[model samples]
Target: MGSGSAKTYRLAFNGTAGQYFGIWATNVALTILTLGIWSAWAKVRTKRYFLGNTTLD
Candidate 1:
């Protein structure tokens, strides 16, 4: 009895929530200091950090 259905699997990962708070705090400080350009830097930094910390299987 095989009905075609999409089966999905998820990967398990663990990351530091504390570090995210720190990242946000630092981003705010840098943006205030650099006058908005640091916003882009912060976005890229956050993206890379998330991507690097993510795992796929």
Candidate 2:
């Protein structure tokens, strides 16, 4: 491949069910406690979690 050529990276998900469930459970609890006001924050948190666990290599 030429130096100027586009490179490809593999996308991998390293998040485990147990780890995700913990985050989800916390988000759910907080959302309920805040009367759904925490849903937006929960969404951001979930997205960040997923992104953080994903790898590009």
Candidate 3:
């Protein structure tokens, strides 16, 4: 009976899987090149990338 009064929400992904893969690959390469020293920065970047692209409605 209240169906018409219900609100609808949508969630979306602003980032593509390919883009994430590229970023992941690059980070892995750089981390290895630096002998794992770049891992910390890579982790931060990876987390930021996902968080930035995630959206709620």
CA lDDT scores, all candidates in order: 0.87, 0.95, 0.92
Q: After superposition, how far is residue 31 of candidate 1 from its true place, in Å?
A: 0.3
Candidate 1 runs further than 4 Å off: 1-7
Residues 15-44, model 2: lDDT tens digits: 999989998999999999999999999999
Considering every candidate listed, which one attains the maximal TM-score?
A: 2
TM-score of each: 0.75, 0.79, 0.75
User: Where does model 2 exceed 4 Å of error?
Assistant: 1-7
Model 2 lDDT at residue 33: 97
**For model 2, what is the error of residue 20's alpha carbon versus the real structure, in angstroms, after optimal superposition?**
0.5
RMSD of each: 2.7, 2.9, 3.4
In candidate 2, position 32 carries an lDDT of: 96
* Candidate 3 per-residue lDDT over residues 1-57, each given as its tens digit: 565777788887799989999999999999999999999999999999988998889
Task: List the candidate numbers ranked by lDDT, top first.
Answer: 2, 3, 1
Better of 2 and 3 by TM-score: 2
Clashing pairs in 2: none
Report residue 6 deviation for candidate 3 (angstroms). 10
Across 1-57, the per-residue lDDT of candidate 1 in tens digits comes to 789897777776556999888998999999999999899999998998788788876
